[model samples]
Target chain A: MSKLSKKQKWLVAGLLAVALCFGISPVTGAMHIMEGYLPMGFCILWYVISIPFVVWGFIQLKKSIDANRRNMAIIAMCGAFIFIISSLKIPSVTGSCSHMTGTGLGALLFGPAAVSVLSVIVLLFQAILLAHGGLTTLGANTFSMGIAGPFLSFGIYMLGKKFNFNKKVTVFVACFLGDLFTYCVTALQLALAYPSELGGYSASFVKFLGVFAPTQIPLAIIEGILSVIVIIALESYAKPEMRSLGFIEQEA
Target chain B: MVIHWLWVLPFVLLLIGGLIYKAYRHRGEHHHHHGFGHKHGEATIAVDTYAYHSGIAHWNPAFKVVLSIVLLLFCVISDSVEVSLIIICFTTFVTVVLGDLSFHHYFEMLTIPLVFLIVGSVIILINFSWTPMTNVILCLPVFNFFVIITHDSLYVTVHLWARAFGALSAMYMMSLSTMSNEIFSVLRKAHVPALLIELMNMIYRNIFIMADTQNRMRNAAESRLGYVDYRTSLKSFGSTISNLFIVSLKRSGHLFDAMEARCYDGELLFLETEKPLNAKLILMALGVVAYCVLVWVMTRGV
Candidate 1:
């Protein structure tokens, strides 16, 4: 075949641009693996991997509830808060609106274990109600958005505090990294399931990462900034609630 | 061969137009509030709202749950296009015809997952290579590499898309027809832990109240031009979320106090309404299962 003329080359280029735009369209706010998207084996493996964290979260929740009967109500409220946050559309310069993960704030407040439980419930709600995720893929979704993201986010917050970094900046970095890590784990999960014929899992991973990057990066940044603002607002307006949750020191 | 390749131009343009229409139709005006639909003036109440009013709402929750699970499992494991198509049709009949869900709403809900599936399938469809491959649909040359679409990738993408739609419809059948409270009751019957059930119940209940509060707060902010620009919207959203957190804390505390005043114990109990499965429904479910197995066997190795 002969090489294409300039106009034909530009036409091909325009077509490719359109195709890529459609492929990366962030029209849907959902980041979870859709129903039956993964192979059965991957589904079973993810469920097995996620069960322990969910059980541990339940145990922590049990402990807190046993210590105080009111904790059940408080925890439920937190879970509901996470659900509402995820449903809200956040403004981004990327022109693709998406929902907030809200795991960062939940992890910072009630610890990672409890946030895992909260997120599982939220994921279930999304699957059943919003059809954003799926029951079969619930394990994978929880592992990425709940278990992996919040644990790393909490770890960062603790590390930042131990080193005595600027408080607001620490919150921002922790929340931001946590949100980004959640998307990374999601991409990894997708790549594992759909490895390319050419470069196998790693190449597919890069492709998935590239696909998620344009929209998710902005969402992560928004999550970080929103977390900082929420914390500051909480400190000012909800001092008693913050102190009760042991998030703030009690004034003498 | 060149003419065959040129057909892709119109296809791409059509797809672009379809996507633009979809985007315009679902603009963020639907703001996920409690007690409403996303479409213009449609009466969609998430899942529960539909479930409560479904024509099949009185059908046994346990039966619907079990049948939906069986269909979902069959759809995924069978990996047959015929089976997926059958399940999709069956689910549409059940959810839209029998359950009396709005056809428009059902299609809208299906589009939510369809967008994600399309995006994922497209990623799987396109392949990158250093050398040319057989059955190439479109190939674009880059620096020392080629972007290609192969026949094998297209086949895999179509297979996945079919299976996902099948499984998704099954889930919708369950969720769209049965209320969350009913599902919790069924879970309780299946011996799920009481604590987790209670937590789910509370969270489900609180979700509506909080969503309403958030909706009101957002509307109030919008009235004050809180979302005029990106920076202003961020500030408004931040304050709204923080205020929502504080409000939730207060609501939970008051709820606990109210429960205690009403002689509440640590465990929360809900009254379960009994809805038994009829023989006709059982027979129909069995027929559906048999149909799936038959399809799987017939379409094996396709």
Candidate 2:
């Protein structure tokens, strides 16, 4: 490395100040790959990757729908819960609030594949009805929020169960990691699409992570806490409803 | 070389302005003393209301979907600044003028996506290097690495921003003019899996009811001083969501009972208003495709 001249030092200081300003700044946008953000090739690739999971979800849904008359209404209710959760403002430390991804809770309740199907519909609603996300980027968003996050969350919950962890601790960790993983996957998607000329994809990945992950950290913790509280509340007041929904096992 | 760096100033300014404006608006909306009445409810319902009331909502929904997708594909694939600009203006014209959406509403919706666009593009504009280069516009050294904004990165940022904004406008046009129920019906007619369509219809039906329940619960919490502090707010929000979940479960059970009373089957049949695809709509779609091709051809090398 070359020695920094006086001018270079000034430039460095100025830029650091700017970067710091942005670092602490509140996030105003929801976390979705905006329309046309990805190139055509990447968009197609994500759709290809996400389709199988969504299809599997569809098959599972069909089975359940076929098994019972009320399945459709129950699934639809879960999907609606997703929409409401996303719209609810989870107050952040920065004063400006962020929307919870809400997939983790759905995953915890109905399992991952089921949430994937519901998430695609909810994503479509968000794209068209809210103008927050977009049509072209739906596949990418679905993969992150719907598939990857939920699958890991479901897996972690299972793991927590097998390891005989506290139920509340399990719920909190599962939800928190699920939320965090969604942002990581989003950053990865962006980095793959727009790699930097200097240091390539890895560097681009770090930069994207730097931009998004910090803001998401607190939100993830809050989501975990919120999920735990909801689970506790449900166990206390709606045990029979939970059992009917098949989240809790029915007694012999 | 330094003068070339000035091009990034407007983006930086716009970003800062948006942040300040967002923070200002957020503060304006949430008064801690009042505790709970805010504008969150209106936003969720805003775009849908516009779609239902749009001037051309009665048009064949499938045609509108096709037109927007075609235009969107062109915008994304062409990656030409001029073509993107044309698409943006054209779609905005369709949405605000012909579709009769208010200019204010259109612009407000546009800004939501623009937040992500601006952030992503700006990130792409920045480059990291281990050693200093000659073409660096702005450089910062963190440890041994130099974080710099380069000319090429700036060019990419502008191009990406334009392309994204163009596709977004096209999507907005389709969304603003076409109701989602109509789109679902169109999908059903197009033979998308029957299961998916039924689920969508049901979900669409449930969303309003849940949102209303949520709003009421939130109001109840506010009155009880549930959100007076951070911890209380968390507890309140959690219970509110828990209540919403329980309510949804009960409501679904009730809905099933009501459906059973009507001798219902598994499938849901929606009565759609038939809108014919007229010659005018086809001609207009063809016109858009032709315009896109013309712009593509003209801007080939640029």
Candidate 3:
């Protein structure tokens, strides 16, 4: 196999970073930490702050749309689809239930940019109804789960594609890694914010690993397997739809 | 649970002050964009930014360190309702005064925990377990406060709404300002395990992708009139969810293929964007250490 280029190496690095963060501490729910726990001044500060990145993502989406109108719509539809599916929860241990975020699928399809746009929308809806995550945290949440996750997955996907690896294996690795990355970042964020409460980095990181690994690791593997299965199904049954969505071309 | 008057007083004062500060700041800052007039908007933002930007975003990291240390110390030293109340009141006050948040916001945030506190305290009082006088004194006032303030019932009928919004607001502030990417950089620099770091990155990326897919499916379902009822709609929803899982699986497969094509060898590398630690940041670290020491000294006897 050919060696990775500088860009690919950077991509891998970025992906690994995201996975470690999320895996260490999965951002489990739609809304993370609620309002009024931290000092209110801090909340207002972050709200004003995350605007630039959100705007930037939209601009990127616009450019992508202008470049490929049909593909853009399909991508947008997929994004919307993910938002809806993830909202539905399933029962889990600890009297709490878990739901699928579907971010891994987005990364596999239209790449990370599309996932960014979708994340903003999903978080918006969640804030309105369930109030799981607050409006203030929207930007940060978007940056963490939305922007970082898809980008990492896409980068991994591209690397796998270049290497001529088995298609199924490539997808499995990408999805698993992407799902894991979200949790790791959540842990790190928790460590930073509640260092004393969380018992500093070492303690918090260990606690996060201990708390999340049992649930999240298995969840990642399940998600990865599910993603691969879905892709296979799409290839077989919905080939036309997949092609329209730009998952595959007639030549491939 | 000996609630120290002094300990409780500081906690309440600080909390209220923090809230007021946030509320005041929100009123002055016209730059803030509350897209939907959500309650506790400013407070939420403040908490999110504090969480996200605590260490890296040119802010005083010592503030968070000190605050956490204080909270922990308080938790350890004082285990009484009086102390809890004092801490609650002080924290609420800080939230209101310094944070510039509304009283209603604080009330709403504390509503759930308040209920639990009241019920548990009352039960203890009724049972006459372990110093009935203490229980009666604490329970009556708190219950009375809730009754006078909100006029809610003490029965199971009262909703047990999770304190999700308040908790999320705090969590958000913590996450928004801090860059997760920078965090990984810090971890790697600290020589943390490479495997652990790799896992974190992968999981994070997949969350957004999963969310995106879920969103798309929801829109499609809505367009097709899939969410009107409970039973049929749930079935359809189940199918949709299953379909999403399948789609995710396939996508992951494709991504895996792509990675292999690029010659990925399971190892990840990257460049660092952070500059050398500045004097101010170092000082901030030192300040955190000093605060820790101070907290240790203050709580030594307790």
Q: How many clashes does the backbone of model 1 have?
A: 1
Give one digit per residue, the lDDT tens place, for model 1 in A1-252. 345677887887787677556644443375789998998888888989999999999998999999999988999999999988887777777555478899988899989999988898899988888877789999999999899999999999999989999999999999999999999999999999988877899999998898888778877888999999999999999988999988886888
Tell me the tens digit of each residue's lDDT in model 2 across A1-252: 356788878886787667545433324346778888888888889999999999999999888888886878899999989988986777667776588889999999998989999999999888877766678889999999999999999999999999999999999999999999998999999999988888899989998888777678888898899999999999999999788778898899
> Candidate 2 chain B TM?
0.83
lDDT of 1 by residue, B1-302 (tens): 34332323443454355445555666775544343545211222456677888989999999999999999988888876677877877887788767767667678778757877887887888888888665577776655678777777777788898899999999999999998888988888899888888889999889888888888898899999999998999999999999999988999999999999988886677787788879999998898788678657755664
Clashing pairs in 2: none
| lDDT (Cα, 0-100) at A176 in candidate 1 | 97
* Best candidate, DockQ: 1
Q: What level of docking quality does candidate 1 show?
A: medium
lDDT of prediction 2: 0.81
In candidate 1, stretches whose alpha carbon ends up further than 4 angstroms from where it belongs are A1-28, A250-252, B1-44, B135-138, B142-144
User: Native contacts recovered by candidate 3, as a share?
Assistant: 0.06
> What DockQ does each candidate score versus the true complex, computed on alpha carbons?
0.58, 0.56, 0.05
Sorted on DockQ, best first, the list reads 1, 2, 3
